[model samples]
Target: MSQFWSELVHNLDPYVPGEQPKVNNLIKLNTNENPYPPADSVLEAIRNATDDKLKLYPDPNADLLKQRIADYFSVQRNQVFVGNGSDEVLAHAFQALLKKDKPLLFPDITYSFYPVYCGLYGIDFQTIPLDEDFAINVNDYGDQGGAIIFPNPNAPTGRLLTLKEIEKLLINNQDKVVVVDEAYIDFGGQSAISLVNQYHNLLVIQTLSKSRSLAGLRVGYAIGHADLIDGLERVKNSFNSYPMDRLAIYGAVASFDNEEAFQQSCRAIINTRETLTDKLQSLGFKVIPSTANFVFASHPDFSAEQIAQKLREKAIIVRYFNKPRINEFLRITIGNNDENAALCTALSEIITS
Candidate 1:
């Protein structure tokens, strides 16, 4: 809206993140953040990193963290690329790999950020619609000489595509780069990182924010062919050499160190997600089969907006996208035992009344 703004800035429509409530008492499930805290090791490492080292710059390459991620995923250190978050990693990908001669392809109802990134980079793109069940049918994506990207257990919808389906997509589009954003992969779905070694054009992006419970720490990475990683590195270095800070590097490294705590938390969230789905269905909400840390459901008798408003009144918040095809659905994050119970109690009251 400013006269000084460039044409690109003037035409840009920014992504709106989930609301972070001002008060702490509210049960916040709007953003699909993990309900568990970061592993004790992660916190201890971050605290230990706070020293005179704060005066110096962090490793611009983030070699240690990259090696940790690479080892954990069974990929080489050269194939791993770390960034501020998966969002930043994705931004680099869109710029380096996705912007091609043909329009990039993605799901119409997938992550809203994809389109925003395209707009920022001036990348031409096309959106393929999900099927009637809100699931991605890879057959819809024909080999068109353009790049492809989508979430595994797709955002807001929480519908997961199996590994076989993903491999099929990779085979069909062998010539084009395929990016699978696995931000929620650990909750239930298998990571495509397992196949990155097989597919030269495959790039798998993940975040510690969800399953690793490091949303505040802001660490995300991508695993792919060393050549692709080098391309992303070129874009990253050209933009910002120091994307990962000292504390974030140490903390992210520690996150990979404690596999037990990480798996335990993911299991807890999966259990809660199932329980919540059953409860919602019993209350007349048609719940989607979700493999992520959240559930997407719609009530037959109540409106999504009305449910969201009522829940807010009860100090509970869930994500409601007022967009096409999914306006009636609410994306509810799986909370811990007490929080889940409280959410159910609030919903029961609201629906019964």
Candidate 2:
């Protein structure tokens, strides 16, 4: 390590995202990204925005996108805060709301970025372990943390925590902020935006990357009480004045108008997820019940790392974690019909050979 680095930089353990290989024609299902293209209208919106507007700075507040998101979620404009992506929005959140007197709490196996954010912000934190089935046990939180945050239908495991459980947690910890990361909530899970008004402490974050098929656009937003939104806005404005660009703002706004494409893509991914789960189970895999657009499975005979390596050799990639309790499982994103079939065929060949 370089001596020029600051103390915080030296101690940092950054989050490692999934690999983005340039290998062509490979079946890539490692990252949980939508395989479908966004609505043609969204593309057209971006094209229309490509004029001389690039020379000028975008709306610092991203008011138009916020208005559309607010209308979609039935929340007021004052309750919405837009960011570069959910990652940035989450970063601002950890600094604004989560760093309180007590330590923050989150599911141990949930999103990996939570801990990285805590470290970056110098916030004290604690992890509550998921149950044996990899499901979040809300009772374990027990009003201990200064704030709470977790993916609704959790990542890597593809398990969901019911809204009732979320409400219970909110009721128990009424004084603290509760952030629900709903990046994959549109697949088979309902969004917590509906309950945001009921719990003033609740903040629901969503992205256009997954459901709206705009991963490249890098736009995400949060819906919550106006007071909570104000706190996040304060942090955001302090860091960057123009988080959302002109193209992203227009494209994300148009994405909200494409209801048919959004619904169709969500349904297709959900269907493929179920089919992939059944196919894996037929091949002696233990597939967890998934509400998200991915399946988490493990085989009794083969280890997760072995399976992952074998798939990579065959140009098929799926996510595998080396951490405790989940090291044996592979988190496979649901691809298109042809890609899914190819993965299944490859697995069958690997299992037999």
Candidate 3:
């Protein structure tokens, strides 16, 4: 290690995002990105924003974007906070709301970024194991943390918890913060944003990168009580007031305004997800019940890594983790109709051969 590096840097383990391969015309499905393009109105809004406005910094407050989000979620602008992406918002959250005397709590198998944030901010955290079925049983949490956070439709497994279950944790853990990272919530699950007004301790974070098909733009936000929002604001202002660029603010606002297109795309992904699940099951793969835009499955006879390698040889990519309970499973993103068909065909050959 370099002597110039800080102690934190020397010990930090960064989160590994899935590869964005440069190969052309590949059936890319490793990362959970929307296979559909953004609405035409979103493009128009970004194009319209390419005027003399580029000469100056965007409103550091991101007033119009915040207002759009607040109106859409039925919250006040003061109760909302926007950042370059949900990852940035989550980092600020770890530093502000989660760093308490008690250790933060999350699923042992989750977004994979939660623990990284804890390490980055020096936040104490403990991992509660998912139940035998790879599902989070909210009752097990039992009010033992400074804060709680997890993806609703959790990553890798794509399992979701009901609003009733979420409310149970929030009610029991009212003394501390509860952050719900809803980056994939728009696909088929209900949002915890509906309960933000009821729970002052709850902060629901969302991103346009997945559901709105705008990963390149990097826009994400959180809805919470004004006090919690203030904590994020303190951290954000301490670092950089202009976390969101002019284009991101404009484009994300347009994404919120184009509700019909966003919903339609989500519907498309959900439909394809169901179809893909059935196709996998028919081939003897035990696919988990998924409410997100991805499916996690594995065949009883074949290994996850073996299938992943076979798929890769055919120019298809899917996620295979060599971690604990999930090592046998493959996490496949639901792509467009053609892409799904290609994946199905590839799996058929791989399984039959």
lDDT of each: 0.93, 0.92, 0.93
1-353 per-residue lDDT for model 3 (tens digits)? 89999999998999999999987988999999999999999999999999998999989999999999999999999999999899999999999999999899999999888889888988889999999888998877765777888988888789999999999989988898989999889988999999999999999999999999999999999999999999999999999989889899999999999989998999999999999998999999999899898999989999999999999999999998989889999999999999999999999999999
lDDT of 2 by residue, 1-353 (tens): 99899999988999999999987988889988898999999999999999997999998999999999999888899999999889999999999999999999999998899999999999999999989899998889866789999998998888998889989989998998999999999988878898999999999999888888888899989999999999999999899999999999999999999899999999999988888988999999999899988899999999889999999998999999999889999999999988999999999998999
RMSD of 1: 0.8
Please give, for residues 15-125, the per-residue lDDT of candidate 1 as tens digits: 999998788898999999888899888899999999999999899999999989888888899999999999999999999999999999999899999999999999999
Worst 10 residues of 2 by lDDT: 137-146
lDDT of 3: 0.93
Off by over 4 Å in 3: none
Weakest ten-residue segment in model 1 by summed lDDT: 138-147
* Global fold similarity of model 1 (TM-score): 0.99
- What TM-score does candidate 2 get on C-alpha atoms? 0.99
